[model samples]
Every structure is written in C-alpha cells, then in structure tokens.
Target: MIPLLFALATTVAGPATPVDPTIARFDRCAALAKADPAKAAAEADAWRLGGGGLPARMCLGLAYAAQERFGPAAVAFEQAAREAEIQRDGRAATLWVQAGNAALADGDAGKARGFLDRALALPVLSSAQRGEAFLDHARAQVAVGYLDAARTDIDQALALVPRDPMAWLLSATLARRQSEGPRAAKDIAEAARLAPDEAAIAYEEGNVASLLGKPEEARAAWARAAGRDADSPAGRAAAMALAGKADAPPAP
Candidate 1:
C-alpha cells in the first residue's frame, strides 16, 4: 500500500504570488496531517479563523480525511463544492471529485456515486483529470459489488493513462476478484515492473503467491512490502497475513 499522499501535483500551479496568510496556514496544516493529527487539527482551526476559501477548505478536508475524521471531511468538501458553484470558476468539476473522494472515505458509497457521476458529466476536464475520475469511479463501483463495471471503468482509465501503476493495480485486483488469476498476475506484474519501489506492488505479489499456494513465497513478498513503508496499507496487509499463519494449525 502507498502512503496515501494527497498527490499535490494534481493542483494547478502558476506564478507564485505572495502567499496569503490563510493559504500558508493551510499548507502547514497539510504538512502536519502526515506527522501529527493533533497539530494538524489545531492548524485547521487557525485556517478557519483566517477565512476559509475553497482551496483552504479542501486542504482541511483532506487533512480530516487522512486522519479518518470522515464527517468533518465531508462537511468541508461540501462547503468547498458550494463555494465553487457560487464562484462560477469552472471548478465545480474538481470540487465534485474532491467530494466524491471524501464521501468514499466516509463509506457513503451512494454519496460518492452521486458526486462522481456529476464529475463524469462535466465536459471540460482535461484527459488526465478524466482518467483520474474514471479510476475513482471504478473504485466506487467495486465498493458496491459492481465488479464488471469496475473492470470496464478501469480499462477505460488504463487506456487514457497506460503507464499509471494505480490503474494497473486496480485492474489486477478486479481481475483477481473475478477469478481471472492469470490476468490478475499479469497486471500485477506489469504494475510492479512500472513502480518497483512501491510497496503496494509487492503486497499484491504476496497475495498472488498466496492464491497460487506458495506460502513461503507469499511470506517473502509480504516481508519485502512491509520493509518499504511501515504505515502503508501493504504493511497492514502483510501483518494480517502473518497473523493468519500464526492462527493456522501446524501442517501434519
């Protein structure tokens, strides 16, 4: 699993103006969210005091989501969406994506679908944005047990960005769920090749090894994953696999 960074590169950057005090505070909150949730929460309060804008609210929402404070995250995202609408800056599409992500994090699949559907309907998004939206939409589909639809959406996302490791990972997981073992293995291998440093790829490799009845190989793969990022999803998965081994009776 990856570190779940907010992918700040997704935001458009231009010539740097003198940083607004509020935006600067928001950035501080974002940084603290990765290392100290309590400090991030304090910074978020300061950001609100500085007069929250759409970007500020979104950052706060991301911080909350990262800390698993889903309810407050949803509220912040919702406020950002409304502000985008009022501003008529054509940022509604982006806001919808943010809202969808927050809703998904909150385990509100219906709300996620509603926001994602609106985002997909927007015609002005760049190709990369569309690809990201498709990938996230596929995730919502998978969460609701719409495996086939998730597969199709992932295929579309991959077509748009063939080199995206996450797209390949999503496709691989969907294939595995569908019992297409060979296809899943191929996809996971491709993703691993593309992102050799990503712990998630190794975790997926461990899963494939387990599915193929190679327990020792699985353990080795998961160990590699756990070594890369102790706080990542891959590390948690590896720990789970280790626990399972401890619970199983010794082979006769």
Candidate 2:
C-alpha cells in the first residue's frame, strides 16, 4: 500500500510557478505514514478537517495500513476513492485498488472483490495498474473459493504483466490446485527463474515438482527454500515437507 501511494504521489504535478503545497504535504505525510503511522494518522485527521481533500484521506489510509489496522484503512481509502470519483480524478481507480487491498488484508474478500472489480471497470488505469488490479481480483476470487474466476483474472494479469514473478507464482499455484500438472510445472519454472532466491517461489516449485512426479527435483527445491530463510513460513514449511518425504518411496 505504501508503494502504491508513493507511486501515485510521484506522478502528481506540482502547483503553478513553484511546488504544490498540497502535493508536498501529501508526500511528507506519505513518508510519515511509513515512519510514524500513529502521528501520521493524527495529523492526517487534522489535515482533513482543514480541507486537505483526497491527499489527506489517502495519507490517513496509508497510516492505518502501516499500523495493520486494515478495516479502518479500507474505509479511509474507500472514502477517498469515492470522493475522487465524484471529482472525476484520474486517480480514483488506484485509490479503489488500495481500498480493495486493505479489505483483502482485513479478511473481507467479498468486499475486496467488489472494490477490485470497480477499479477494473474504470478505464483510468494504466496497463500495468490494470494488471495489478486483475491480479488482486484473482486473489480475492481465490479467497472466496472461486477458483475458476481466479484463473480467468490471473490469466488476464499474466497477459498484461508477464514479467511479474508473483503473477507466475499464483498461476502455478492455481494450475496445481486444478490438477493441471503440466501447466503448473511450466508456470512454476518461470516463477523460479524470475525470482530464483525467493523462498516462497522455491517452495511452490517443490510442490509443482512433486505434482509432476519428480521427487528429486521437489526435494532439491525444498532444500533451497529452507536454506534461503529457515525462519520464514515458506522456508519452515519447505523444511517440514522435505523431512517428511526425503526417505519415502517415489509415488506410483
């Protein structure tokens, strides 16, 4: 969410003849949201009362997100998005994307789905931004057990952002879940190539290799995952998986 907000802020043009005071404040507030979320949230509230408009609301959302208070973050982002829409601001779609991400983080996949779809429905997003929205929508679909819907959205994301390792990783995971072993293998291979050192990708590579009946490859991948970060969830899971299967006979 910080990355998204920063990206948006970087693209805003400054005021006439000099720097835009509001934009500068927004930028400073974004930094504060990362460095001091509680203070940022308090200042953002005061800024909003002083008519700081979309930027103030967005900073408020960012502050909440930084604190992992995702429900309030989603509410703030949604309000900003709605106001942006009313103003016909081109940034409205991106704000909606932020709201959707916050909703997803808060474990409200249904709400996330609607918000992400709203972003996708808008034509204001760049190709990369649209791809991101689709990818997030796919995640929301997955959270709600709509695997088929997720597959469609993920495919769209890949079409637009084929270079994104995360997209390939999700595609591979989805393929594996659907029992499409060959597709899973292909997707996971790409994901591994793109993000060779990522423990999560390596862990998924192990899963895909196992599905493809390549126990040796699975073990090797899992070993790499565990070696990469023994404390991480993926690394720990990979270590456990490798231990469970290291001496087992190959699947028939």
Candidate 3:
C-alpha cells in the first residue's frame, strides 16, 4: 500500500492540451465527483453510452473512486485505458496509471503491478507521471516483500522528483525497512526539511533515531511530532515512542 505520508502531496497533472468542449465537460464531471459522486457517476455512465469516449469512462472511474467503490473504479479505468490504447492516444499511460491506483485501492496488488508495468512501458508520459508511476510501482513491490526492487524503483522516482517530500519519505521508509539506519536518517531529514510541518515525517524521524540508538534525539523528535497534533494517530504514536514503549503500534 502507498503510505498516506507519500500520497499527501501527490496530484495527477492534467494532460497538456487545449481544453476541447468534451474534455471541459469531463473536467466538470470530475470536479463534481467529490461533492456529488452518485450524480457524477450516473452522468458519466449516461455520457459513456452517448459517444462520450475514453474521457467519459475515465470520469466515471473517478466518480466511482470518490465513492470508494474501488473495484468498479479499477474496471472502468481499465476499460478507458484499453480504449485509449486502441486509439493510440497518449493519454493511455495516464489511464493505465489510474487503473493501477484503483487496483491498489481495491486490494489487488498483483493487478496493480500489472497495470503499473504497462504504464511504465508506454512511450508517452510527462516526467511527473513517470515519477508517480515509479512510486506506485515501488508500493506494489513493497507489498510483495521485494524490498530491494522497491528501493530501486524509489531511486528512479527520486531521480525524477528530487524535490518531492514524498519521494524522500518513501526512500527513508525503504531504507528503514532494510535496516540502513544512517541512510534512513539522512533521507527522512531531507523529507522533514521539505515538509517541516508534516507530523508523519517527525514521527519517522524519531523512529530512525531510535533505531540508531540515539535516545535523546528520538525523544526530541517524538515530542515535536506529538505536539504537531495531539489527537492524530501519528501524534499518539509519537507520544508512545517518547514514553519509551518497546512495542508501540504502527502510526497511521
């Protein structure tokens, strides 16, 4: 699964093209998804059958995803991706990546991996899309216990998005999982530098410090994390860590 910390700043950049009327309509439907998912879904479905094309199907998928109906979202995105492929549209890579994300949300990591691999193979994608795809692929690798491969994927992601806090966070997490304390500490420090107010980064900083046997550093980091938002799960976990608990539960 992609960590919430990593997902926080990620947004899909829209395709680079002049907004035609159809795409404008699709965008409107996509915007309505969060506020009125049912209505948006119904509209998208109706549009799909009335020459609405791949964009309408993609909009329908987004509506389903907004409702947390990930299974249907994945199916819709897959269909849209296939249609895009048939038309030789550059947008197929984006659709495939969206399919991968929905499959991940639906708890089908294998399918997610397949979709992401296809996305990565596509010749057309912006650097941002390729970087995000690598991150998503790394998540699938992590799910299947392929830590080393995940590390490689994350490195690729970082190369494309060097300034992204989430990239550094993921790199830190992968390093920690591999017991590379110094690397984890360095990467997490970079993440904290990029997003100083992120409680999750502080929490992970504490974890890395603790793993390196720096009690004072860990305690200080945890205290900062706890103070960020005391009611949050990350804050609660930070509090626990600062208390020197040996077996604290994982943070959200």
The candidate maximizing lDDT is: 2
Q: How many backbone clashes does candidate 3 have?
A: 0
Could you give candidate 1's per-residue lDDT for residues 85-193 as a string of tens digits? 7887576777778778778878887788788888788786678788888888888888887878888888888888888888887887777677687987899899998
The local lDDT score (0 to 100) that residue 83 gets in candidate 3 is 96
Ranked candidates, highest lDDT first = 2, 3, 1
Winning model by TM-score: 2
* Model 2 Cα shift for residue 212 (angstroms): 2.4
- Candidate 2, residue 219: Cα displacement in angstroms equals 1.5
Question: Which ranges of candidate 2 are over 4 A from the true structure?
Answer: 7-16, 245-252
Give the range where candidate 1 is weakest over 10 consecutive residues by summed lDDT. Answer: 1-10
TM match of model 3 to true structure: 0.85
All candidates' TM-scores? 0.72, 0.90, 0.85
**Root-mean-square deviation of each candidate, in angstroms?**
5.9, 4.1, 5.5
The list of candidate 1 runs beyond 4 A from truth reads 1-68, 214-216, 246-252
Instruction: Pull out the clashing pairs in model 3.
Output: none
Error of 1 at 25 (Å): 9.6
